[model samples]
Target: SQITIPILSGDEVNAILILETNQEPRFSLSDWDFARRLAENAGIAISNAQLYAELTRADESKSEFMAFAAHELKNPLTPIKGYAEMMLKGATGELTDQQKQIMHVLRTNAERMQTIINDLRDIARMDARQFRIELSPIDIYNVVIETLRPFMQQLEEKGQTIVNNVPEGLPLIIGDATRLIQVMTNLVSNAYKYSPPGSTITITARPETSYRTPNGNLHKNVMYISVADNGIGMSEEDLQKIFRERYFRSSNRAAQDQPGTGLGMMITQHIIELHNGEIWVESKLGEGSNFQFVIPLAVEEGGDTPETSPDAATEPASD
Candidate 1:
């Protein structure tokens, strides 16, 4: 009254049927064959999922690798482009005021290009985990003052405000000051670029002791700096890719024909990592943004804390 059968084909096989002796059994090869087929289908589905997951991981890794490589190669290229552009316009030779004016434009664009290339290179180097820190003890308050002085005209003409939140008596830190300045420049420039005509950009600096390695050692007290703007913030999707090498442009870039190699954050991130720091962002799509990064506080010396309105219409820094 009972019958049992096993179905076998290729490496994949299905269920074995069992029938009790107490009941009449009406099973044969046909029923067993169908059951085996169903089981094989399930195995195939599982295999597909595994393959898909592998593919996703590979894609992310490849993206990260290329991005890092590209960033590392772009930094030193800036000055090269700048001098070449200058010579082409005969900056060394005397020229009329009109000619000099056009040459100035050429220089400006060249500088912008250099910024983009360098930013890309730095970010890539960081992503690839090959960046080395070149640190020194220096006052950031002086650094900010010097950096903003040149941009004063631009800010004033646009009716923009620059707020400093760094207090006096803050201890100097051992950091690559030039690179640190670059980070602030990128953040500040992005804030200014995205803010409306009459808005403000605030730069803040404060001592932070919260960043600690799992080991008990205090990971050099850190400094938290943020460049914030009340501008046309960004979407979650846009925010997700801000540090990605992939170009994600807001509407302003498209309309103004804003140009960049889209490597600023890639470089900024690398610089931060090289200094043993952290970086992150917070924003609302239409309201504002705060781009924050931290650096080792005592990597050289103190405690300190210090220091936007935008409704719309500017480039929100290229990714």
Candidate 2:
């Protein structure tokens, strides 16, 4: 006698298991049941393994393509920017007020394109495990101030108030200055983008008695930095998906008018994790949102290192 069993992957039958035995009863009912269970589990395991391999290959291909495309796009930006600047400066020729304004817009947009290209390059580096952070002792408060400075004009134009509550004499933490500034800038930008005019964005810093690491270890002497906004708060679902997914947009009315690629928070989270820190958010639907992260006050000497390559590649290429 022969026994046949369907092996399923998802809802489809991926294969079949067959058993033929010559015994007194060939196979008992109990034995057949056991065999079915084993075969079903094996089918699921095999399906998962196959899917993983396929996804891995596709991700590698995507990374290579992104790196190539980002590099190609970056090459032409220099001339575009230079020409726009030259025209604005009258290096090409004198221009009327209207022409000057148009040239200014061209230059500004070119700069924004350059920034997007740079971000793409960073994403490629992250996929390739080439994204590096130079760590050193730095004043976190100063970084926050500098990051907020450029946005002052925009905030003022919108009638928004920025209150910097980061106090002086905060313990210097080991961090990648540029990356930390980028994180702060991203958070502050989100606050500015989502909040209505006349709303206040507050930057606060304090000492955390205990900070938890990603690996479930808690460290002492931690510094906490937060950016809070009284803008349209996100739903619980949005908050849960924000950092974990790419190109996630909020359904809030305040955010609907804002233009963003939605990659900022994703990049921000990776940067904090690179510093061996953790990030989180607190929000209510009708209230507001507070975004925060913590880093060790003092890193152990010689322990400065980037995250593992496999870990860095986990995030998709920045869009």
Candidate 3:
């Protein structure tokens, strides 16, 4: 007696399973049914394996392209920014007020382009597992202030206000100060970009206990930081997908019109993760959004908590 079953993936046959037996009884209905089920499972597994391979290839290709494009785009920006700065400083000659304004615009756009390119490069490095952070004991308060300094002019121009409520005396955290600044900058920039004129963006931080790490370990002390803005908020759907998808821009017209590559949040998430931390958002449509993250505090050699002054004044960054 002989029995054969075809393994199918969708409508196509992927393989055949054959059974041969020399006995008084031939293959029973139950045996044939079991064989068919087994073949079906095999076909599904094979299909899934094929699909995963294709996806891996596509991801590698995308990473390569991103790296190449960022490199090429950044190369030309060096001279563009350099010449703009030189002309603005009268290296070429004295400029009229109009010419200086033109140079300022040129320099600003060039800087924006450079920022986008750097983001792309960071994304590529993250994909390639080459992204790194230099850890050190740092004051979160200083990081917040430094991050806000560059945005002061932008805040003034947009009529936006930044309330820096990051208190002093918070326990020092072991983190990359530069990366943390980058994370803060991205959050504050988004707050400014989305909020209406004269709206207030508030930054706050505090100490927390018993925070859990990704590897199931618990840290007894952690620093919690948040950037809250009364800008256009997100829906439940957008909130769910924001960190999961790259290049995800909101469907809101106001959001769509804003200039962004949709990579800031992604990079911010990665930086937090590198510090063994987590980031999250809370928002309501037409209201505003608050972005938050927590990083574990550093412990001293003798298990004593080394502390700083938590008495930093709560004030606006524009101050």
Q: Give the winner by TM-score.
A: 3
How many steric overlaps does candidate 3 have? 6
RMSD of 1: 10.2
Q: Which segments of model 1 are wrong by more than 4 Å? A: 1-100, 123-130, 211-220, 251-257, 299-319
TM-score of each: 0.60, 0.73, 0.82
How do the residues 23-65 of candidate 2 rate in per-residue lDDT, one tens digit apiece? Answer: 6777888888988998889888989999999998998888888
lDDT of each: 0.66, 0.81, 0.89
Runs of candidate 2 exceeding 4 Å displacement: 1-48, 82-95, 211-219, 299-319
Candidate 1 per-residue lDDT over residues 208-280, each given as its tens digit: 6675433343544677778889987877877777876455565444213556655677677767877877788
The Cα error of candidate 3 at residue 252, in Å, is: 2.6
**Where's the lowest-lDDT run of ten residues in candidate 1?**
306-315
**TM-score (C-alpha, index-matched) for candidate 3:** 0.82
